[model samples]
Target: MKRLADHLQPGARVFVPGLCGEPTLLLRELAQDPERARGVRFVGVQFPGIGSADYLGLHPEAQQTAFFMSPSVRQGLRERRAELLSLDYPGIARHLQQCPPFDLAIGHFSPPDAEGWCSAGVCSDFLPIAWARAKRRVAQLNSSMPRTGSAFRVHLSELDAAIEADIPLTTFSEAAGGSETELRIGRLAAELVRDGDTLQFGIGSVPLALAGSLTSHRRLGLHTGMVSQAARALDEAGALDPDAPITTGVALGNASLYEWAGRHPNIRFADVRSTHDPTGLAALPRFVAINSAVEVDLFGQVNAERNDGALQAGSGGLPVFAQGALRSPGGRLLICMAATAKRGTLSRIVPSLGAQGLCTLPRHMADVFVTEHGVAQVRELGLDDRAEALIAIAAPEHRAGLEEAWRAIRNRL
Candidate 1:
């Protein structure tokens, strides 16, 4: 611990790995001796739901800068101890490249192989970029981390310091038995996907349900930002293409999925520059991106980042993937969400996205909108027709109110 603390100087900007790549042993050590990290600025891309650590809480003088907002750092934001970059995955990579170099970078990696090469394990998104930009590098070599293949590899000798720890890796397991509405929306979204389509989705009950609905499809390829436990089911059902490997930036699932990915030849982790790049995705045939949102308006605006005027999450890689899927020759962008919130009291299909809600994707980017009621294909439709299609899929109880609101909004236009 003394040797590791020697690298931490006051006012130094340090990069810490987030998600499944977080070094629990190292972070715990730092928290134990708060004086060591006093006045230090910690930066990383910690996600919501999966990331539980509050880096700003490590010390009274500690500051945190992040690209995403989560409950872990919301207090810091309010206290002015945290700053958000407000960028997507690709934007984050670019910022790390052009910004001032970090004083130190601490990352978790799998044990070196016979060739002395260490895999980035479950997270390869921003660690590689931060590693290159930091003046000094440290590696936490975890024996439990699955040694997945990726272009981002680190030699044990490259790191200035190496700490050996065999702690349990962080895991996020979706709850069993999704809600009835989620299953219905999943079935409708699955109907839009062909047998051989390449898929991109994130972590949620809807995606988990969608994976169950897709077991009968053949030769489905995955080029996604995060690979969940659903990938295993698809593989077991012979739904995924046997020849094509699963390309993702991170593997976030339960311990069983981690054990399955260990030294697995079919999984290839990639950096955000490749995983979230629109041009690369545009070339894939029949690309289908299934995403979710908090709400949508008749104007085709999608708000995935906020709920009731509060920042609940970040606008992750959705916009980038939406662009890619829209440009693909046979691609489809499916936004799946329940027709209403609060047990059908509040309509998610609103007449307009008011100032309280932050629009993650604007009106032009919308394509297929799915709900438990039905599917709304509005990519080629006009403003009036698009509103009609979306209203038809909204919850039946709210249909009358939505139509009345839309008429008033239409007159203004």
Candidate 2:
């Protein structure tokens, strides 16, 4: 640990991996000498295991860079004490292409096998991105990280430093608690799901609740872009089809989900090339892709990103599934969510999206909108027809408001 931190010069920038894959132990040791580490800049999605945002406060010049603003880093970024650099999914990879990179890139890696190459574990996707962009690669080797497959690896000979540690990573957002609305949405989502249907969804209450309800299904498969705690619970309940092609790009969820994924026979962790490949998912029979949306305008445009002026999340895996599900014969692409948020203060079935709303899936591609109220079948509908159907599916409290918006948009009155 001492030797690894020595690589840092004053005002050095360090790239840290996001999610549970953070290098906490290394950061803690460096935090000891507040003066030496104070001026250093940190970069990544969010600080995973780097404890005490207070450590970075030692120096006013200290800042963190993030592709997406996470709640953990939100305060720092908001106050201008830290900087938030917004980049889309593809942009994140492109940002890694810039030269004259960080002083060192740190990551938690699986111990090297007989070949002397260490696996990047859950995030070969991002690790490769960072490695290509980083000036030097330093890894904190841990046995806990599953020795998963990858295209390339960091070798002991090439690494600037290799420290040993058994530190855990952090989660950006915990699972939203299952509510009556979520459960009802889940029940509706389950009706659309059938046997041998390949599933793809992100981490949230909706996915978890839906997965938990699928115990009776058979030959169900998984080729999702991400997995959540509900997916893990389904796996434990013997609902997930283990023998099938269970693929994923990342697992962002609770501790149980992380523990369930570490080299579990059922979970075959793979890269984006295969997992998020639209062509590949389209080929699968009975493929059912479920995504969430922030708001749905009258035109059926799905806003999965942004809320007001702030960026809530990125457009991840939603378009991939939407396109692929359309291509797959007998497949369904469904967007499921509660009818409203803010304690029913506002409707998600909006007359118009907030200024920050980014249309992730266009109206033409969107298939179904399922809420506790009803399922709005708008995939093949015309503009006016779709608005009518969407309004019908909205929660009762919000339907009247949405109808007025629909009427004005259609009649121009």
Candidate 3:
């Protein structure tokens, strides 16, 4: 701990792996004595519920910056104790590529293999890139983190220091079985999927529900940004390709899934450069991309990142998948969401996005819109037809108002 603290000086910036790769023990030790590393900044994205934000709250000199928002860090940003940087999923690798030499890079990794290589395990998102940019690299060799034969491997000799910790890897519980609306949306979205389709399922109740609905499909292939428990289930059910590997940039699931991934030779992890590359994704035959959004306007603009004016999550890999699916030979991009939000009071299918609405996926890039009511194939549709199709999927209570709003905006356009 003394040696770790000694590496940090006032105003030094350190890079910490977020998601399932956060080194809990190392971070806890650093938080214990903030005086030793005053004015130090921790940079990362989507930190799970660790005390990283709490440390920022307690120590005025310490700062935390994130490229994506998680619950804990989002709270800190709201209080003006932290800052947020805007970047997409693939952009994460580019951000690390451009980062000035970092003071230290800390993360969790699997135990060294026979060849003295440690895999980033559940998270291979940007650790390799961060490692190249950091002046020092420290890792917690956790037995719990499953090694998925990721290309993001580092030799044991490369680490400046290694700490052994056997803590359980962080798990994101599945959303309580999707609501009636979500289930209906899932069914609608799943109907678009066919056999031999390579799939990209985003994280949410809707996607999980869609995965459940896909149990009967055959020969499905996975090439996604994040592999969830649902993807494992599909593979277990023999729905996925028997010989082809399930490719993902990150894994976010439970202990059982982690162990399963470790033993499964078909679970192959790659970096975002390969996973989210537009040209590479287009080459996959019959790709199907299903993702949820916070809102979608009549113009087919998808907003997955904001609520009213508040930041919800980052753009993530949705843009990449959407464009990729559109370019695939027989691909379909389904942007799904419940018809309403705020306890079913407000329509998620709006006339136009609110002032702060972010077009995570542009109107032309979208293919299908799914909700509880029905599915709307809006790709290549004109403004009036697109509005009509989208409004038809809105909740019955909000349909009339949405139509009126569209009519007013239609004339203006």
Residue 284 lDDT (model 3): 89
Give TM per candidate.
Answer: 0.98, 0.86, 0.94
lDDT of 3 by residue, 156-234 (tens): 8988888787878777777869788888988888899998899998666888788889999998899898888888878
Worst 10 residues of 3 by lDDT: 46-55
Let me know the TM-score candidate 1 reaches against the reference structure. 0.98
Instruction: List the pairs of residues colliding in candidate 2.
Output: 20-169
lDDT of all predictions, in order shown? Answer: 0.88, 0.72, 0.81
lDDT of 1 by residue, 351-390 (tens): 9999889889999999999999999999999999999999
Model 3 C-alpha lDDT versus the unseen true structure: 0.81
Better of 1 and 2 by TM-score: 1
Report the number of the highest-TM-score candidate: 1
Q: What ordering of candidates by TM-score runs from best to worst?
A: 1, 3, 2
